[model samples]
Target: MPSRSRYDVVIVGGGHNGLVAAAYLAGAGRRVAVLERLDAAGGAAVSGTPFPGVAARLSRFAYLVSLLPRRVVQDLGLRLELRRRPFASYTPTVRDGAPTGLLVGDGEERVRTSFTRLTGDEREYVAWRAFYARTGRLAGRVFPTLTEPLPSRAELRARVADEAVWSAVFERPLGETVEETFADDLVRGVVLTDALIGTFAHAHDPSLAQNRCFLYHVIGQGSGDWDVPVGGMGAVTGALLEAAVAAGAEIATGHEVTGIATDGRGAEVAWRTDAGEGVLGAGTVLVNASPSELARLLGEPGPPAPEGSQLKVNMLLRRLPALRDPAVDPREAFAGTFHVAEGYAELETAYREAAAGRPPTVPPSEVYCHSLTDPTILSPALAADGYHTMTLFGLHTPARLFSGDPADRERTRERLVADALAALDTHLAEPLADCLAVDADGRPCLEVRTPGDLEDELRLPGGHIFHGDLAFPHRAEEGEPADQAERWGVATGHRNVLLCGAGAVRGGGVSGVGGHNAAMAVLGR
Candidate 1:
């Protein structure tokens, strides 16, 4: 028999978003509890001793922290722990023995130059920045109101009508947007690459214009600095958990939520822990799992299924091979991150192949070598020996495992690893195999979550990470009441139950807008 306890609210999932919601609700004088299936609270934003004596972050799944709102950190007083380093990235253009045109930078100069090199048009870089600047200002205005009910269409159009904002929002595909603005193919590819990061769409695709909006929503302003915290990405989650604890929020790890019991008054959440089945009732429930996961919790009688993209792989690496770009100084090599796909055409082709349920020969890979910037992440002993840890995000692999007998899936996993290594090899002269420490064997470091699995297990529709796409209709345009209910934020179709995971309007990443906004909504703030 499980002990029955009551609370003002019960938050499911100890992911960053869930912890953020718990902290805010607890701060506001509510008795709250947080339950996590995993023993730890960070979810994807977690770090572990995958290898002995190695403290490398598992940043492969969720790399970079710049997209996180500064306001959220400040409001929560996590400044000291959430350290920021300069943004760094490099692409070495070497042909034969000579250097072609290596691109590198740390601030707006980097953003501008990266785009300029891609399209060969400085004007295009200017337009892109101007567009991003205006969008940032608009986000500042609109995002604050996200916790409230959706806005009106008139308000959305009025905000979008601003000449600068309108151009970026409606008139451009990220590829064409950059192409029209710049003449450099390299710059165009690099700048537009941001628009396609986690999506199955191509840079040149018409639907990509909305992706640009979502991209800018994350790419903060000024210097374009995407820094990692000191200890590791997990530090951010640790701070949130600390805040929650300080606010008197109770947390239980290794406890899996099995179902949600709803009634006129509120919801009764059931879970299976080490002890046994446990249930807690609350006036409001905030779910941090995917929409499909939530649906499973509600059984067959809950809200309609959610629709969105699913996350594929999250691999941790020991070391990244040294990439030498003659145009870049050795010191500047670690300044930012790198996009490995050669150009827009390659990117589009790769996405097309993946969409057909086939893994692309050349998958789009995003590499983040955080240890180069954050010394703390390096093991103290290894730091003395000068060994650096890197995170290679082999994103957008085919959702389906290769079809075959049991042995085929195993071979498929090997092929996926080979594909990832091959992609890295093509970009850098010295591939990861040369500097390798840990190799992915057996199952994939992380398998792609199927839509059915997302619904049945994680409870996310389409296994989409953002709950839903962060495009125009989903955002309900600029002035409209934010129709992110499907995304799973503060607003739920139900009266008291609220959504607070990456599935919400602001959407995924380490940002806590989903949770913070939900808290405010619950308090009717």
Candidate 2:
């Protein structure tokens, strides 16, 4: 139980956003307390040693860092090292019965050569550069406003100042724009992957959910580069935990919040531990959980649980697998994202098939080898012996497919994993299974996480990674709310309680924008 019956602020969860809010508020000399249900904090952003007796510590759920703002790091004085990957991405394909692939990296000449080698001309490369140039401009304008009060849709469009770019990205469907810009199927698929990460939607879905997902993927820190957090994702939480504790914020793990009640002025938070139950009064409350969870605590009806749509697989490799194309080295190809079975037509077909209650004919996925970029995550012996780690994310595998009786779910899991691995084997010189590293128990060091697994382990309803459908990082088209807290995109039905998690506007990724905005709202900035 809490030492006292009251506090200046009571946070409902101890995820990274909650820790950030605690650090800011406590540093400002307000009594603050953070309650986490799990034994440790960090939520989805954590690392684990899954394979038995495996020395390699892998980033279990959330892997890379892109949306974390530089201001958060400097303000909290976090000790972190985010290293850039040497390459961008490599996608293997068969052209004219010959093995070939597209490789994108730092050198302009090299990239131009690769494009010319694949497409038999330079037109596609020029269009690729021009298309990203528009998103780059949008990123420069929109990313800076995340910490500020929500901007009206019209206001943000005006700030973008390029009507054509805004229309292509924000108004029209992403598929139409992509089809108009690129001719090559492989090239188009690579661009569309950004829109479909963790999202289940057709290319031309009228709701334009894909466009919102694509926008967040590209606008990180204005440059949109996803970097590896040295020492795995756990290091990020460690830094935040240290900062919050140093600022006098109390962290209470293994304390599950059961209910929250608030009138306009103050609130009471009730929680339970193994020992017993307790209640604490607070002048304010910040919820670092999903909107559905918050509604449960308030005893009110909430929206349907968001359905997650992806498969996460982690593996330890004794040696990197060989690629079909000999020109590109395995190290360079796996350094960044490695695309498989993600052609434009293939992605559309996969989405259509999965939507119709069938497994994807060709599962679209991407893989990354963080060990190539940052080897410190491995033991000294493993690193010296050429061991590497791989993280794979497969798309269009929705949570709905895994539902039914226990035996039915098992059959679904087996089929999906088999199809995904088969799709990957098409581009490799040898089967991926051949490169697996055996653990101390003489078992293959491979772990798979389905959406259902995430829901059970992390309390994520349906295991939706972003908590729910990603909203535009701005106010709605109709108008802005009159309440000050609502204007910051953190307000709930209750006045004293605010949302500080991925459910908040502009809170999709690992960014601390949600926490910062909520703090500003409470401080009446």
What's the lDDT for residue 339 in model 2?
96
What are the per-residue Cα lDDT tens digits for candidate 1 across 385-427? 6556655544455335443565865665567667866776764
**Model 2 regions more than 4 Å off:** 477-481
Predicted candidate 2 versus true structure: per-residue lDDT over 317-357, tens digit per residue: 99999989988999999998999999999999999999998
Local accuracy by lDDT, each model: 0.61, 0.90
What value of lDDT does candidate 1 attain over all alpha carbons? 0.61
Using lDDT, give the best candidate's number. 2
lDDT of 2: 0.90
TM-score for each predicted model, relative to the true structure: 0.83, 0.98
